[model samples]
Each structure stands twice: as structure tokens, then as C-alpha cells.
Target: MSPEAIRKFWSLIEETQTNILLTLDNDALVIWLSRQLRREEFLKRVDTRDLNAYISERLPLIRDLAQERLAYQSHSSG
Candidate 1:
């Protein structure tokens, strides 16, 4: 990916993260994030050629973080 594309991709990830945090909408968050990552990974791998491998490696941690975020949102909302 070009520098501009890289910047845009990160910007989008940041925006998506912010939206997820602000809305606490778990369903949409996961789907949207997945789609975004898939699209970017398909166009050009972010850091490696095997994007799925990268995702698989990070998935556990990502899941943990998402669960934690959901828990926090649930507790805070109530």
C-alpha cells in the first residue's frame, strides 16, 4: 500500500474504534471492523501477506478486548 493508503486505513480503523467505543454497539462493531480489515487486507496486507494469519494470531487478544469493552459498556450503561 502506498503511504496515503496506509494512512487512510489507519484513520479508518481509528474512526471505527471511536464509533464502537462511543456507541457500545457490539454487533455492528464486530461486523464493521471485520469488513474493514478484510477489505484492506485484500487490497494490500497491512503488515504481512497473510492477513488471515495475522488476524488469527491477534484474534484471541482482540476478542478479549472486545469482551472487556462490552462488559465495561454494559456495566457503565446500567
Candidate 2:
């Protein structure tokens, strides 16, 4: 993937709602991310056709990010 594509992908991940990221199971999360990345606006901003492969490869990291975010939220709120 191009550096720009990688940056955009992470940007999309960061922009995604925490609930969606945290609540969805792996399959559902992949579906959700696929749909999101396939949207016209996303496509217009970045070429994501090649990103499908990256998504599966990075899913574990994505889930880890969600867990970290949840922990941070809990810690901050407590």
C-alpha cells in the first residue's frame, strides 16, 4: 500500500465510532469496514481497492486499538 493509503486507512479507523469498533465481532467488523471503505467519499479520497487485504491483516491491531480506547475511556472516567 502507498504511504498515503496507509495514512488514510488509519485516519478512517480513528474517525470510526468507538462503539462500532468495540462492539462488532470480527466478521461484522470486517463487513462494516469494507462497507465504509467502499463508500464513494472514501474511494474519492483514497484508492481502497487494494486495502481489502490490509484490513484482514490488520484486524487484530484494530481490535487492540479498540480495547485500548475502551480502557482509556474507563480509566479517564473513573
Candidate 3:
């Protein structure tokens, strides 16, 4: 994904206030993004415990919003 898209994804995560991530399926895409966002470099920049909790709590919601955004972009550009 583009940097702007990635930024927006994280922004969505930050905006959400639910635990959708923990309830979602543990598929490749979810796992990959979770691992990427949880890297040592990124974790070091924030409160590790809080960040993990926030991401786990919001990932699914963030994914849903990201997909919606992508679909909108695709349709608009076509």
C-alpha cells in the first residue's frame, strides 16, 4: 500500500474505540499488518503495552475502514 494509505489506516485505528481486532480471523493480511506495526522500532516510539492494546482493539475496524476507503478510491478513479 502507499504511504498515504498506510497513514490513513493508522489514523482509522486511532479513531476507533472498539476491540474488533481481537475478534477477527487470524489470516495472513491481519497477521502481517499486526506484526509490522508491532515491530521493535515502532513499539519503542510509543508505550508498548498501550500501543499493542490499542492496535489489537482497533485493527479489524481499521481494516474495514481501509477497505472501504480503497473501494471508494477505486470506484472514483475508474
After TM-score superposition, what is the CA distance of residue 67 in candidate 2 from its true location, in Å?
Answer: 0.5
Q: Which stretches of candidate 3 lie over 4 Å from their true place?
A: 1-45
Total clashing pairs in model 3:
0
Q: Model 1: runs farther than 4 Å from truth?
A: 1-35, 38-49
Candidate 2 lDDT, 41-75, residue by residue in tens: 54545444456667878898998897888899899
lDDT of 3 by residue, 1-78 (tens): 335445744764554433443345645345545555655354445544554555566656666775676677679999
Clash number by candidate, in order: 0, 0, 0
Measured against the true structure, the TM-scores of the candidates, in listed sequence, are 0.46, 0.76, 0.44
Q: lDDT at 55 for candidate 2?
A: 85
List lDDT for all candidates, in order.
Answer: 0.53, 0.77, 0.54
Residue pairs in collision within model 3: none
Kindly give the stretch of ten consecutive residues in candidate 1 with the minimal lDDT sum. 47-56
Cα RMSD to the true fold for all candidates: 6.7, 2.6, 8.5
| Cα-lDDT of candidate 1 | 0.53
lDDT of 3 at 55: 51
